[model samples]
Each structure stands twice: as C-alpha cells, then as structure tokens.
Target chain A: MSECCGTTATIEAPVEPRVAGRIRTVALVGPPNSGKSTLFNRLTGLRQKVANYPGVTVEQRVGRLNGIGRGDLTLIDLPGIYGLDSYSEDARVAVDVLHGEMPGTPAPDAILLVLDSLQLRRQLMLAAPVLNLGLPTLVLLNMSDLMEARGGRVDTLALAQELGVPVAKISATRGAGLDAITHFLNRKAEAEKPVPAEGRIELPVMGNPRSYRQWATGISTRTKYKAPLSNEWTKRIDGVLLHRIWGPLIFLVVVFAVFQVVFSIGQPLSDAFGEVLNAGGGRIGALLGHGWVESLLIDGVWRGVASVLVFLPQILLLFLFIGVLEDSGYLARAALIADRVMRSIGLNGKAFIPLLSAYACAVPAIMATRTIENKRDRFATILVAPFMTCSARLPIYMLMIAAFIPNTPLLGDFFGLRAAVMLSLYVLGFVAALGTAWLLKSSILKASSAPFILELPQYRLPTVRSLSLRLVDRGKVFLRQAGTVILAVTIVLWILSHIPFHADLAGSVIGRLGQLVEPVIKPLGFNWKIGIGLLTSVLAREVIVGTLGTLYGADPATQSLGLQAALRHDLTLGGAMALVVFFAFAMQCTSTIAIVRRETNSWRWPAVQFAYMSVLAYVAALATNQAILHFVH
Target chain B: MVAIALLSDFGVEEADELDLSGAWKLRQLSELPIGTVGVVESLDLPGEIQHHLMHMGFMPEARVMVVRRAPAGDPTVYSIDGFEVALRRDTAGAIRVREYEGQNTRQG
Candidate 1:
C-alpha cells in the first residue's frame, strides 16, 4: 500500500472512476511485533515500508497488489497502534483511517488481524475490538513458524471455529503460506458474496466487569506456554552492552562512534555530491543563458535543493544504523541501562531516542517526543531536543574543527579524536537541553511527568528494502521542507544583503546590515559576513553554508570543496570557536519550529522555545568568545 | 519450598517447574509461588495489546489465571482484567508480585 507513492499513476483525481468501484483494499492492523508488518511485507513483497519501531510509521503507507490471479487488490498498512483509544498521532491515524476520518482517505474494505500465534490470545485482544468495530476481519495467524520452532502449537481449527472467521496461518518472515494467503485474499476481493467475519467476543471471567465481555471471552480459551530460550550471540553481546555498569558506557561509546563515522566518512561523500550538483547546474545554466530563469534554475531551485540533499547520505547513514540498532533490539537494553542514569536528570529513559535523533535533525526529534506521556516532561524534552547537535551542524563542525581545533596526540591514538570535539558539542547540547528542561519545568510547564513504561520487542532482522524506502521518503520530506523555506529566505536575504547597496558586493544592503550588527556580535568575534550567514540560518541551517558559499563568492556546489582551506586560512582561532558556539545556540531550522507549534498545539510555546534557545546561544557564544580571546590572543 | 511452575519466555527444563499453583489475586503474579497463577496489574507494554487492555479498564485490581505454559516456555497465556493475554516470560518477569489465595483464581 505504501508503494503507491511517487507512482505517477496518470489516473484521474480521487482514485479514478474506473478503479474506484472495483477496488478491493484491506488494512492490516495489530500491535507492534504481532507481525502485522511482517505480514504486510509478505503480502506486498518489497513494495512497502516496514515499521518496526514504537511510535514510528507516523503516516499510513499505501501499496497496491493487483491481479492476484483473479483480480486487483490494494493494501494499506496503518501505523502499529495499541488500541482504538488512540493517544498519539500514530494511533490516531490508525483509528482515523479505519473510520475514514480524513478527507479522501476511504475506509478500508476489510481488516487483516495479524497475530503472533505464540501469543495468539493477546493478539485477539486487538482483533476482537476491530471485530466489535464491525469491520469484516481476516485473522492472519502469523509467526506460526515461531510456534513450531519453539514447540508451541495453536489449535487453528478450534480458534477459527471459535472466532467464526476464515483464519490463514502463515510465517510472514520466511514467506511461507503466502500463496494460500493471497489466494484467500483474492477470493475475498473477487467474490461478491458477503462472508462477514463472525465475532463479538465474550470477555472472560474477571474481577473487573464490563458487559458483553469482548475482553473476557478472549481470555477464557486461549493457551500459551513457558519455554526456555537461549541465543548465544545475543547473550554474549549483551554481556557488555547490557552489563550492569558498562552497558550505558558501551552505548555511549557506540553512539559516539556513529557520530564520528557520520562526521568523518560523510565529508568525501558530501564533496562528491557538491561536484555533481555544480556540473548539473553549470550545464543547465549554459543551456538556458544566465538570467533570472537561469538563476532560479541553477541557484534558486537546483543548487538550493541539491545542497540540502548532499547531506542526505549522512542523514541516511545515521538513521539507517539507528534503525538497525532498534530492530536488533539492542536499543531496549540500552534504554534499560540508561533509564537508571537518565531518570536522575528528570528525563524519561525513552527520551534518549529523540535526543539521539536531534543529531540528524531536530524536526523529527521534537515530533518523536510524543511517546513521553507527561506533558511537562515531553515539553522539557522537546525544549532540549534541539541541543543534540544534529547533522545540520556537521559542515560547520567539520569546517571549524579542521580550522581551529588541531588534532591532539590522543586523536591519532584512536580513530577521529577530532570526533571528540564534536562529541563534546553533543554533550554540551545535552547539558543545554537538560538545563532548559529543568528551567521550563520550574517556570512554565511545571508539572510532574507520568511514569515511563515500554515493552521491548525481541531482536529480529531488519529488512533493507523497507528501511531504504523509509529513508528516501523521510529525506524527501526533509528536502522538500528545506527547499521551500530556504529558497524564499535566500532570495529575501539576497535582497536584504544586495539591495540599496554600494557599488561593490560587500557594501550591499545585506552587508551593511551585517556591518551594523557585527559590533553587537564582535564580543563573540563574528565579522559582518558571519553575522549575515547566521541571520540567514534561521530559515534553514543549510542556508548558512549556502550563505557562506555565496558570501565567499563561490556557489555552494563549487565552494564547499575549499571550505576547510578557506575557513582555516581566514578565521582566527577565537573566530572559529565563536562561530561554532553561535551555530550551537541559534534556532536554526524553521521546520523544527513549525513542528513544535503543531505538537504543542499552540504558538506560545514555539515562540518561547525560539526566544529562550536563542538567548542561550548568544550568551554561550559570548562566553566562548571571551575565553578563546583570553587564551589565544 | 517454591517450585517455579515456569511459564517463561525460557522453556521449562522440567514440567510444572514453577510452583505457581495457588489462588493468587491479580496483583500477585510477580511474587506468587514462583509460577502457580498470573496477576496483571497493568499491560503497560508499548503496542496495541496494552492499549486495548487498558481501555477495557484492566488495571491494578484485575485477577488472572496462569493457564498452560508451552513446552518451549513462551507467551505464558493468562486471563487478566477480564481478558486473556499471552506474554513472553521475559515480559512476565517485569511484573511486580504479591500474595494470592486459591479461590482468587479465575481458572481452576
């Protein structure tokens, strides 16, 4: 169902008249790890995204699986939800899709209740409710392979008799029984005869009572077993990774290693991407003849959008590895270990994931904070999330670190000790996040946090196709967002810096404004050009690089290659450090701010977030400026 | 002596290995006879199962019956808060324990 994106269908508006009446669509809904995703993957083959994390799969994925030997079929994979009592957007989306709550999102024709046969009855806990929802449901008894491997068995015949639905058993991972499953779906899709699912589950006897007992009947007859489980590699790895003392230390070290890889390995890739963008633009510019048309094509759209995309590989590499760690389930153990430590600092252990995300981009990181229930804690989390020193800061970090922070002998002792300087920036970000969270709790969002609770899914292999598709989709969103806001701001800043200007480029209106502002920032050692770039960065951080690329009289595509040399030869020791401090504090991305407004459901907090973080940046940069001058000058 | 009628994510090396046979209230799954009965104060896990169970108002007072444990010792099926849920023994271990009586059991 998610595969339908970017298809360029050419079918008319609203899903086409020819396709609408005959279209057969089913949505797979279940709890995380009940194997809904595995079923979706199996059903759609490689034509979809697999969501294996809690609170991800924020949007419903649509994919089409047509001509199953009978007719066409379509499947939409809704987010992994807990229940109809939806709390988060992920859960709400699931409910909303089921009810056709959003415009143009038609209600699914049927629901496939994907259940882990090992936990068959609990799977029914979700299944029965959907049945109660009156949607015709087909319970796919998934993970049957696990049942066999573990020596557990399900009475499929009895269960089907009990639920009165045609049950199809399949092991979604190894792709067994898929043909039969698809055939059954094909039958349902093609046949006009209404085979309504039979169920209004009676709740089992319990101390608590609610009539009709949809919950109770599910409890009464189901069976499960106690089994010994041993996987040597996991135990061995968990030795250090989940160790009582060293676990968190190892997690920190692993996280730091990833950052080092992103910062260092990403450089050459970024350089290569710059060349491609430049060549592509220059050829197009020549063809079009340089004018506003050429400028819009080369500089306005292509160069502007491509510059942000050059960072994609870095962001992808980061998110890909993060996804793997999460899928492998090491993240849960890390969370458990970190919980003891993070809880002390007034943040939930779960906040660690979003905080880590802040390194790639704060927009999603802030959105990811929804998993935290305590409003105050969640807000505090969002407040500090920006400080995590995301990938946006990488170019700036690489430039400044290469220029000012010379490699210590300790760096050569290990891989990229230059990474340590960047690592310290992350630590600084955390400190700022916590400091601000503490301040916010005491002042404005001053309420206690709900206790953090989460179930850790067992480790499993993450499918690459789904993960990559997800990266492309997310990167597309990031590019789209960065392009729109940055283009408009870049032109505006260009006008601001270039107009009512002197004959020379440096004396342009934007330059004079920077010059006027440079004195205020001089304590922080910023020159007017740096000031202008910093000002332009608020619309988008990538723009700061472009602003520099343009201010240095080089287009971003061509100019990025010599940035290290340029900054190194040009910037004073204090000047480089001060620039780092400024980037560290500035409210650099507008998408992040927009997300904040939506998440908080008010403009007030986003406004406050901007003011407070900016003030923190200014003060921090000034102090760093004074300290660097004292030491080196 | 407490014999764990082990319904665990880990298979029992011996049958009825966990001595959980007792009338345990819903609050005592963690501390009851190592494994006779199961108590579910809350299904606070991350997924939809937890969400549904909570919506059914299954909380601190709901009693559960620790039904059969598979030979492989996974997904210990139990009746709780008027609903049945199967849990990996690893998840069950995370539950807090208390004392229980025989009549408190929903499943004989």
Candidate 2:
C-alpha cells in the first residue's frame, strides 16, 4: 500500500521540522475547484499532475517547490474541501494533514490558502476557520484574470491588513504572481523558529460557521471590494445544456461520439504500432538465428511490451476527452442529468463520471471514484466498474464478430451485422453493471441514504498546453505499466510455454495445464486450444488473439487474417459467440486486480471481484453455447 | 407575468416572536418556482445535513435562487453565492425560505 493508505496510528517524530537534512512542508489548502491544483502545478512546473475537480486528490501529492531554499521546499497539494470540519472524507484528510494526525505526514511549517478571487465573499467562509489555525500562513487570491474580466478588482493590501497575513493576487491558470508566493515561502522558511501563536488569534465574531460568514462579509467591506457580476454566459449555456428535453439527448450524443473516436481512431494507431514492433522483433529473431535468445527476445520481451503498448491510443484519447469535459465543467451537469436515472439503480449522480470513464478503461475509472463522498456509493461504483466493456475487450469482440458474423448490412451501409453485435455487447455490459449495483446496494451494502450535494462550476475553455501535458502524463503511466508488470508476466508465461525445449508445445508445461483444464471448460464449447488461450489471456484480454495465432502456427505479420482464418478453421460459430460472451465478463487483467486491492486497501474485495466475475462469465458462456448449438447445429 | 402573479398570491402570517413584521411569507424551498430568489429563513434538517449546508455557504439569511431542475424534476439546482448546488427535492424541503424583496430586510 502507498503512504496515502497507511493507518492513522503510526506517528514518527516531525521530519520536516528538524530541517537539518529534510525539506520544509507547506500545504496548499482550498475549497473545491478554487484552482489550488493549478497553482500547485504552476509552482511545481511540469513536475506534478494537476488534480482537477472536487475530491479528485484522494491521496497526498507532495511536489518540490523549485528554486526555493536549496530547492527543497515540498508543497503538499491537498484535496479541495469546504472547510476544516470533518464533514466528509476529503475534509477529514485536509484536517489530518493540517494537524499532522495522518501517518507519514509531518506538521506543516506553513499554510497557503488558495481562494478564487472572483468568489471572494463565498470563499472567505472557508478562510476564517483556516486562519484560526494560526500557523505561518499566506493568502493567494487566484483567478485575477476572471475578476478583471468581470470589471472588478481586489484590494490585496487592505485585505492583508485586515486578516494579518500577506496576500498576493494571482491567476493560476495563466501563471501570474507565482514569484510572490515563492518569496513568501522562502521568507517563512528562513524564520528562526515555527510561530507558536496558537491562542493569539481571536474567533471570527464567534465559533460557528454562521459567525464566520458574518466576519468574512465584514472583512470584505474593509477591502473596498465590490462583488463581481456572475458569469451570465454560463447560465445561458446551461439553459440549453441542462434543458429538460435536450440535456439527456445531448449527453447521449456526446457519449456516442467518444466511443466512436476510441474505436475509429484508436484501432489504426494500435495496428500501426503493433506492425512496427513485430517487424523489429522479426529482424532481431533472424539475427539471433533460432535459439533460446531469439525466442526470448522475439516472443517474450517484444510481445509482452507490444500487447500493453497497443492500448496507448485509447488511453490518451480517453484522458483528453475527460480533461476537456471536466475543465469545461460539463461533467457536473451531465451528472445532474444522469442522477435521476442512476438513483433508480441506487447510485447518486457523482458516480456518473467514474462509470462513464470505465468504458475506456477500468483502472483509471476505478481511481476516479475518489471524487465520490459516500462510502457505500464509492464501493458499489468500484465493484461494478469492471463490468463495463473496456478497450481491452475490443480485440476479442472484433475477432469473434468478424470471424463468426457475416458482413451483410442491417440498416444501410452504416449498420452492418458485425456492428450490431458490437453495439449489443456494449449495451449488455452496461446493463450487467447496473444490475449488479442494484443487487448489491439493496442487499448487503444497504445503509441510510446520504444526501447528494454537487457544485456545478462555471465553464471555461481548456488550454492546449495543459491538455497536452495531461495527455502526455496519462500516456507515460500506461507505458510504465507495460514496461513493468505486463512485461514481467509475459516473460513468466513465455518460460512456461517453452519448457522442455526439444519437444513440441503439445508436451510442454502449459500444454499439460491446458489439457488439465480442458474438461472444466468443455461445457462452454472450449477445447484444449481454447483453454490455453483463456489461460494466457488472464495476463491481458488481447493476448488471446495472439495466443491463438501462435498455437495455430500462423505468421504474426499479417495480423488481419492469420488469427481470424485460423479461428475460422478451428472453431464453430456457436463456440466463437460463447468465447466472446465469456471474455466480456471474465476478470482477465492482473493489473486491474492489483489496482482494486490498492484502492480498496483489501485483498478480500479483489478476491470477491475475481470470483463473481469468473462465475458470471462461465454461466453466461455455458447458456449461450447450449442455446446456439441446440438451435443451429 | 405568470411567475409574478403566482408570487403575489402568497399569504403572510403574523409571528409572535420578537421582530417578525408579518410581511414575509415562509415556504419550503422545494415549493418555490424555478428562477425565484428567496432568503433562507432556517434549515430545519438533521444536524449533519444542516452543518454541511451551512459549511457550503447556505447560511441563514443567505439569498438562494432556484436555478433549474433535473430531467426528472426531483433533484433541483439552486444558485447560492454565485455557486450552483444541486440537491434532491427531499433534501431541499428541509430548507425554509421567504421570498426576497429586493434585499434581506429582517435582521437577526
């Protein structure tokens, strides 16, 4: 488990306070969507990934404040919350880090409060509680550009005098006024000792939030600041986007376009990359000349990396769309539109973002569930996320539909029989996910209903530079996974497949394992070869096509026909459909299970996830094969 | 014109408490028409819900406007302090508000 998941009990002495060899810790705290993450990114510069939206920063993200105090000042970017009170999990995390109660985090030497300057009065309600903490603190009035655009200005000096803290006006999105923040941190870091004026600060009028708001309003009057006019264009756009009749229709069209991009754009790029890798591997094999080194280089390392690298296009495109949607603030409106339908299935609107992302890949989708506040809602969302047909299942689906179903048009050139089967599979995946959540929520995970409160932030254009940086970071993560776990698994499976070097694969260790499991899967119309493909595919779903290719002794270069033609010669139509149905529900990826364990912080949930998915796959495949064979064969 | 006519029909009842002038009519926020602005009278809800609402800037005497409703018209969006917050109608029912007359004239 990562440091973020460590228990709250373990507390080592304050590490950063000693300052002899360690860096100073300064926590950046703010309310939801106040540009705290954007400021963190600007201060840390391309070294950190900006956590966008509310509750997205579930774990602690510490970044180095470059060029400040021996370049060793660590800036901890915390989850955006309303205040210090423990009303939600994200709020609790902020409180823990502020008080140094969480394991592996030391008491902060300073607190930097990032507030949206345009919404100063509303945001200052949060400012009062944090100011009462009384550590060495500085206030950052962010979004000065928007404030100016709305014909308003902030009296930074007057506000600073009233609050007894240094205040700087900055635009985190445009990278303005960051040097003032650096100077503030440097000045605070060089102080002789940590300020101990804990009880010196008076309560803002009184202790409760009502008094805090009153105090905040009073302080606003001293700054000679006028409330900026709210963005009328956002509400205008919402009139159409959040319309009673058109909102849901537009949402469906947007979702359809995303999937179309994922398939139409991602498929060719994957094929092109696969071809380049195969050509390079083939040349290396010829040079090494028919030995274990040749086999290991061509079949083990190259193939493993190739399998994982193929999903790069889909991952990049998925994050790109997600960035645009979230940065534009349309995701909140979509969640609101989806809330009505989702509530019928026992989930709140907040689960919609994670659930939608699951269509591209389940790993990131599962991670995105951190934004959901309710524990039961988050768990239910995670457990059913894998049931969505991810990009990994595309290869298996395409191979099956192409090899089994004819290319006859169903409704014009637009909708072919093959396309119909693909669409049905996606719909089936969503239906199954919804059904599982409904069952789980009503049965074992039932609890008192939690109220849903989602803030719909104003829309803004997504900058090209930030979007490209996010795209690159997501691509890097996917490639890194391909380099490590996926690479290792391929090598291990390669060794198992090639043991007893003198004999054929029919007599190898993997061959024996396949034969052993053949009878168990035979009821689902899978023979020994299919059994072997299923076993190797547990490493990744796409590996089944490659495994079937190697098992049939076909050339890997002509990927279009080698596997498809071989499968056509080997399997019946009923069996092909059964395989596709099985792949849809099977928990095939080891990385997904690993992520589940880490996210849930338990081995039991992943185990339960694996068991339930496998059983569901087996039963569905059996029924599918039996019905198809009885009617057609 | 229809919304204005509907607003003018609200009946105000006199209160025996200290300073209520019998000029404001109290109503559940969920009962207000879309786009109507109201001043929060009080949040008669469970302690946790009330605390969370206050923390989110839905304080007593704060002006809130009913922005829009979901497709099913159950969870409605309310604009408070320039932020749009969407919550279920059942949750909104716990909030008591009086129609805003230019500004909040009643003092605590």
Candidate 3:
C-alpha cells in the first residue's frame, strides 16, 4: 500500500507540523555492529564523522540528507545502543536525545531503526522500546546480503505488518535496497503527520526481558524468519585466531608489527612530508624577503603547522590499522586476551582497545574510553590515556634516540639499538598507564568496575570507502588542530621569543621566563633554552622540537643542521635522556586536556590530571638525570 | 588422567554419575569444557554485574557454549543467541551452568 493511502493516514493529525521551516532531525539507532553506521554513511555519505566503536561517539554527528522532502533533513547517527536501561553513556545520550532533554538538540522528528537481519529477534528488543516513544519510525533490516548468503530469511512485509511501521530489507554495506527507505522517508515527510497519534499501536512495555524475547520470537516465527547458524568460516577462523596459546602470541605480534610498520613506513613518509613543507616554507621566505614578517610567517606559523603535519603519516597508518582491526572484529578478541592484564590494573578488558589506540594519539583514545560502562572505570581510563606514547611524541623521541643511542644493529639489522630505545620509550608509556590506572583505581576512584561482557561481532572485510573516510576524517582533525590551537600557540610563542626586537634570544620575553624557571628545573639538567621548550611543549608535545629549533637559530621547518645534530651539539647525554623521560610522563597536549574535560564533564579532573602528571614528569626527569650523571662521573 | 583432574577441579561431585561417557558436568562456565553445550543455571555475580549480563542475552534458560579462550585462559569466548560474546573468567565464573542432557537441547 502507498504510505499516504495506508490505514494509519486516516487519523487526523493532532500535533503541530514539526517541519515548518526548521530542519527536521531524524536519528538512526541500532545495536552495535548492526551496519547502522554503514546505512548512515550511505544516507549521508561523506558528510559524516565516523566513530567506529559503540558508546564512543559522545559528540552527536548530525549529517545533512538532501532531497528528502523535508527542506533540510538532519540525520543524526546516535551511538549504537543495546537497550534503554543500560548504564552506558551512549544509552543515556540516546534516551536523553529521544526525550528532547539534551541541550542544543531537539527530539528527532523520526527514527530510522536499523536491525541486523540475521539477528532480528535479538535486535527487536531494542526496537520495542524505541517504538514506545511514539515517533514516526521506519525499520531497515540491514545485512540482508549476509542473511541470504547464510540461507536465512526475514519477511520485511510481515515484519512491517506486525510492527505497524514501514520496513525495508537492505544490505547497507553493499548499498542495496536503500532507495526504498528514502522513498518511505519522503512519504513520511509529505504526510503532515509528524507526531504519532494516540491510537498508534503501543509497543509492549519491555519490563521483563524474557517476555520481550518471547514476543520477538513469536513475531519472527510467524514470519518464518529462521536465524541461520553462525558462519562456519568465522568459526574456523576463530578456532585458530582465538586459540588459547596462539591468540596472545598473535596479538603481541600484530601489535608489534603495527608499531614496526608505523615507524618503518611512517618515518620515510614523514621525512618526505617534512622536506616538502620545508621547501615550501623556504620558498615563501625567499619570496617575502628576510624581515620580521618573513620570520613570523616562516618561523612561527609555517614551522608550527609543519610540526603537527609531520606526524600525519604515523597517525594515518595507526588509524588505518585500527580501522581494519576494529571493523574486522579482531580488536574484541585482542581485548579478551588482554583482560587478565587489564584486571590486574583494575580496568576491564574493554579499556584495552582505547589504551592501545592511545599509542597512536590520546585524543581519539580518550574519546574511545566511553565504552567502559562504569563511570569510575571510564574516568580512570581517560585520566591515564594521555600517558600512552602518542604519535606527537615520536619526533622528540626519534630526535633524542638519534642523538644519544647508536644505530648499530643489536638483534640483526632488523632490530637496531635505536629501535630498541624507541621500543623502551613506548614500554615506559605503557607501564606508566598501567601503574597510574592501578593507583587511581585502588585509591581515588575506588568503586568496582562493571563486568567485562564484550559482544564479538562477526569478522568481515572492511570496505575501502569507510577506511578512506576514516583516514580523511582523522587528517582533517589534525589539520584543524594545526590551523587553530597550534597556530595561536606558535604566534604567541614567536612574539614572546622575538619581543623587544632583540637580536639575542637570551634577552627575549620567553628567554627571560625560561631563565626564571631554569633554577627550578636545573636539577633535571635542563638549561634555560630547554626550559623554554618544556614550557612551550604544553601546547603540544611536538612544539618542544619546534621551540628548540627556533631557539638554536635554525629554520624549524627545514630542520637545517637537523634537530638531532643541534641537540647533540647543545645537550649532554644525561640532559637529553632527562628531557625524553620528562616528555614521556608529562601531560603535554592541551587538546588532550580539553577532551578529558569534555569527556569527564568536569574541569576539576583535568586540573588534577595536569598537576599530577607535571609532578611525576619532574620527579622522573630529575631521577633519570641524576642517575645518568652519577654513572658517568 | 589430566582431563579427569581438570574435571575434578570443577568440583562436579556427580562427575562419576554422568556415565563417564563424556557428557558434560555441572560447573562454572569458566571451567565448563569448551565446545560443550550447557544451559545457564544461574548468575551468582554481584547485582550490577548480573543485571548487565542479563541485559546482554544471558537469561536463565539461555544455552551457552564455549567457543575458545585467549592464550591467557582469562577471557573465554562463548557462543549464545547465535552470536559470540567474550567474557573474563572471573565474570564467567559467576554464572553456573548444567550440560545439555541430549543432542536435541533447545537453542536460545
């Protein structure tokens, strides 16, 4: 039947037209890994921000769906949630948004309920509660391709009749049968009955989960929907990949390979990127001539932005691997293997993925901690997430290792002494994360963690489209940071270092400030110049390299004389090691602090985190410096 | 002898009564022989943990089978409701299970 001529169209609309001139908001909701994101991407395509894991998308991503009859249809992709009663942050956000209680967001005009076709009955439990909201809703039975491939059946027509809503079978990943949903949406938009009528079929209150399951099962049986068994191929793969002995071994190798690839692959790309950026900056400087304006443009802006961009290669590789791992469902298996280690630190297994991601970048990692259901555990994870060796620290670590550690092959030419030193720094970050988490869990946030119950989605090949989109989105974030926060910090630092028009940097404002702090940090074997780098690095850890580059009177972008050469000329071995240790323990990223504030919804925690990390950094650096100097003497 | 020792570690007093025919015994889901189908008897975890597990399709009558365990033997994968879920041994220990009596056991 046509949507307008359907029996439900007979009732007179009692509610005001919600789509007058204002944009209509439609929310796409579903269970985890049910292809909700794929459908959202298909509907909104490329005009969306993607966060892969469930409960991690704290920021509500509203994308524009054009030509949907509603003048401007805003499609909000809510985080995948199992049900309304769960205590996960995503559930609360979903409930709050549906109730129009979330500030700055109105309740959705309609809900696009996505369900996994193979697991209809299980997913239907979520649909029941959503139906009770009385919103204009349509169900999309997604993954129908997999369903048919596995000899399963889902009668969309029968399901529509039973649920009293429009239903369409779609394979979101393959982009099949999406037009039907678009047509249904257009019809709903034209119907003028935005608000559901009181006589609409009431969804049974899902007070007893067993009863809800029975109800869902009854509906499915009548429709002749027999859920196919788990794929034999998946079982065979899991048998080996998740094997008791081999699983952990493979996980370690996989993680080790990721880091190896990041450094091995990323270094060359980063060097090439640096060379191009430096060439560009040098060309711009030559064109503009050598004045204060040229200096500010080249030394301040260009170099500052380059410092951020140089890490792009590493960041890209990291996210690419993470996207593949996450989409393939191996991350859940990895988490299972790490659960023992996680519990020892008073964290659940789910925290492992986020902690692992922190090695690439802490910003996304902090955001990824939302999947931890317990507030206390989530908080503990977020606070320590920054301690992981992020890609931003790569430049500084590489610089230090190059200057201090020899490149002689230690274990064959594949593993050099420098590589071991780099690995040790990463290990230090991990140990710090675990130790800090243990202390915080045992002392401050003493509440017990929620049980680790992770649903392992079927492993599948991730589409190139989603992977590229992820890479592009992450690239955009890095560029945005380089443009805004990093730019501002660079300009301010440039002015401070060049103020009073002083030819000698020692007499500049920043130089004076560094001198004042020099005595305090002298025990750590840092001079005033090193002190300034430490101060500026608070904006971003990479800024320390740029700050030092400028301090030593070298072009920061060109790496003229190279950073390692300059550091080796200026810093003692003990001082260089101390600086590395300091950066390792310090919470140097303002962006990380801002995210921590937003995620925890409290400035107090960020303040505590910053203070604690600073103290720890200072003490660790001091001890390392003293021990090294003592041994040398 | 090793299998018997491990079975005894499960403290299944009635392990002898089960025909010694390789029919699974009553044991914690963590100790349950992997690949052996069993019905969820009860979840003895703390209230919040129990509630969270129940919400995730682990009701009283649900049939769960161990799929695999990690190398550490701490988190084991279980298949139920036609989907796989990984649970830590500590959390899995809270749930008690009884082996399916026959091959025709009802699926969840």
- Please tell me which predicted candidate would have the highest TM-score against the true structure: 2
TM-scores across all candidates?
A: 0.73, 0.87, 0.85
**lDDT tens readout by residue for model 1, A564-593:** 666665567777877887778778877778
State the lDDT at A50 in candidate 3: 38
For every prediction, compared with the true complex, DockQ reads 0.10, 0.42, 0.35
> TM-score (0 to 1) for chain A, all models?
0.77, 0.88, 0.87
- Model 2 DockQ vs. reference: 0.42
Residue A385 lDDT in candidate 1: 84
TM-score of chain B of each: 0.46, 0.71, 0.67
What C-alpha lDDT, on a 0 to 100 scale, does residue A345 get in candidate 1? 72
* Index of the highest-lDDT prediction: 2
RMSD (Cα, Å) of candidate 1?
8.2
Per-residue CA lDDT of candidate 3, range A54-101, in tens?
334365676777523333567888878877765666778888877766
The B-chain TM-score of model 3 reads 0.67
Candidate 2: list runs displaced more than 4 Å: A1-23, A49-57, A67-70, A193-201, A205-207, A283-290, A407-417, A554-570, B1-18, B44-49, B100-108
Model 1 ranges with Cα > 4 A deviation: A1-23, A41-58, A66-74, A86-93, A189-241, A245-253, A360-382, A391-427, A440-449, A491-509, A512-527, A539-577, A590-608, A623-633, B1-96, B99-108
